[model samples]
Target: MAPLKQRLSMKIAFITPCNAIAGGLFVVYRHAHYLQSIGHDVRIIFADGSQGRQVTWYPNFSVPVSLLVEEAAAPTEYDAVIATWWETYYDMFHLNARTYLYFCQSDERRFYEKGLDSPALLVERTYCDPRVRVITEAKWIQRMFQNDFGVEAGYAPNGVDLSRFHPEVAPLAPRGPRVRVLVEGPGGVPFKRVDLAFRVTARVPDIEVWFVSGDGVCESHWQAARVFKKVKFEDMTPSYASCDIIVKLSTVEGVFGPPLEMFACGGTAVVSNVSGYDEYIVDGQNALVVAMDDEEGAVDALSRLVSDAGLRQRLSAAALQTARAWDWDQQTPIFAKVLAGFCERPIPMPRTARLDYLLLNRLRRLESAVSQLDPVHMALVRSRSREISASE
Candidate 1:
């Protein structure tokens, strides 16, 4: 690779859903910041037309911003336009760019039921589209795309922001006898499985459970001693430092960051062996890893961490060592290189066939809806509605 100073600067645009406080959006902003730091012209284009909106949740995220509303006049040309989410892929059609890329953060198709949700097919189409270049944050996602979808993708692991999440922040609060356990992710999202985390943590005796939700929702059934909602990105370090262990039982992820963040805050984690945990988590080494949906195993692991002080000390020590190695400065350059390489290649022609798939999916949904209705009752209702309209 050439030196940063010697390389030609490329104009890059990242298409995002909104300037929301999400883990995925944070990653996008981090890459944009790094690329801009290296003398490249970078901007984030919000598809929802949130013009002049800055990401206030994340500290010091000062990348350039633009609006990319559909049917409006297209923005100026760029060397590369990267879609950060599935819905943003359609927005790429209206943009002027030399190269289009999809930043696959996760197998988003798994977020919804296949048959019931119509958008699953649309999300799947973005991965299979041949024209769009693909880059992912997890090796597992790269392999899954290769084996499952036959689309090879570049890989870059997400890095922790060490300045905010580190061991030297502050001392733990004065909880003399009770062990404080933290559970992250929104409770309303099914894939996060916050309910399972609550259930397993409740089995342990005399432990204080804290729930931190991005969506500010806490289910009534959850026995949370304290709930922190929509915490700013910079303000989360104290929460992690105060807890001894974080229980993350997410069913799907593309290199999840909370476990890594917790590790940086001088704490251990009990995580499910989800898709991305193997990237950093070592079972019984740095953090305890249980099988997915293994309620009993998760309960036992949390209980062991609460009761065994020596074990907790060993895991937290090893976890801190792991976190120190994955700084943002080190990881963002790999993603920057991937983007630069794509910009150097020949621009492939846009695939118009995706529009055909979109139309067909909409028709299929309409057909399914019509098939569920009674034809004779529908005819009468339509005739009566027409008569009412004619009278008016």
Candidate 2:
């Protein structure tokens, strides 16, 4: 098939939450940059003032909130309106043009007028508009919408920063038995299942757990659990380089970025069998895949890595190869094709008509059941639930 192309003059506006900028922001920013690189006029608008010019490596343009008065007031003039999250979904919902949802994170109900507080209803009722086209980071999310939430959906997987995160580009080290495993991102997220790392550490006295959850490991959780915590994103790679295996055990996920980074860093990974992980890595080949219900599985996988250097090397090599294949340059075209075609095509409505109600209730129940979770945990579940609900 011929590659899709947009007219050079088409302008695209990407609306996202704020400047604190997490994973979803990073993905959207990269998408905007790639869009601009291919000659489309793209700009990003956030709640805060301005995020300023895009760095070449982190190429995404950010403008201040001042532009929104006019832009949001008459959004129909733009070729397309792209909402990066649920809040942005609301903004695009209010607009007058073809609307597209870049449902990056799993937080779908936040866009609703009432949020996911209602379990009895299939939708927020107020946010039930189904006219917009939806795009997400994984087929699992797509299926969620189609099967549960009943929303029209398509899949556009998140891409790695291959230029920065590559096996070839990362610094190499001498062969060693000391493994340096990292659990990256905002940390402390219970869904991230960092506690499982503690289980692994406890089972295998030789392995240590290094964390990136900013608050550092909770004294009680760490003291009782014996897991170590460090709070930094930049420091993640050196830790990855040093580690033989990296593990993430999110109960629910959209698109897992850290494991892909592990691949780029030439580190093998053991991940929970979440929908998002299935999109990228094949079990036992690229990375170890453990069932979510199997709490000991994570510990066992990590222990095996600690005891077997040859297995780690072999898996790491396969992971690096997998990571190379997932480069953004190659994946962006899929998004480009979908986005450009989105301008002309109608969204594919979800097949399971009951999905909308089922997913809406699932989201509500999940959120209610896990409200006591910490910010990181709550955010992770909320994000994943919303993704599932919104896709439906």
State which candidate has the highest lDDT. 1
TM-score of each candidate?
A: 0.88, 0.73
* Model 2 spans > 4 angstroms off: 1-6, 48-70, 73-76, 100-116, 119-128, 170-175, 214-236, 346-392
Query: Candidate 1: TM-score?
Result: 0.88
Name the candidate that leads on TM-score: 1
lDDT for position 110 in model 2: 31
Query: Whole-model lDDT for model 1 versus the true structure?
Result: 0.82
Q: Where in model 1 is the C-alpha error above 4 Å? A: 50-52, 70-72, 171-175, 351-392
Question: On residues 26-60, what C-alpha lDDT tens digit does candidate 1 reach at each position?
Answer: 89989988889888899888877643567788778
In candidate 2, what residue range of length 10 has the lowest lDDT sum?
Answer: 223-232
Which residue pairs does candidate 1 place in steric collision? none
**Backbone clash numbers for all candidates listed:** 0, 15
Could you tell me the TM-score of candidate 2? 0.73
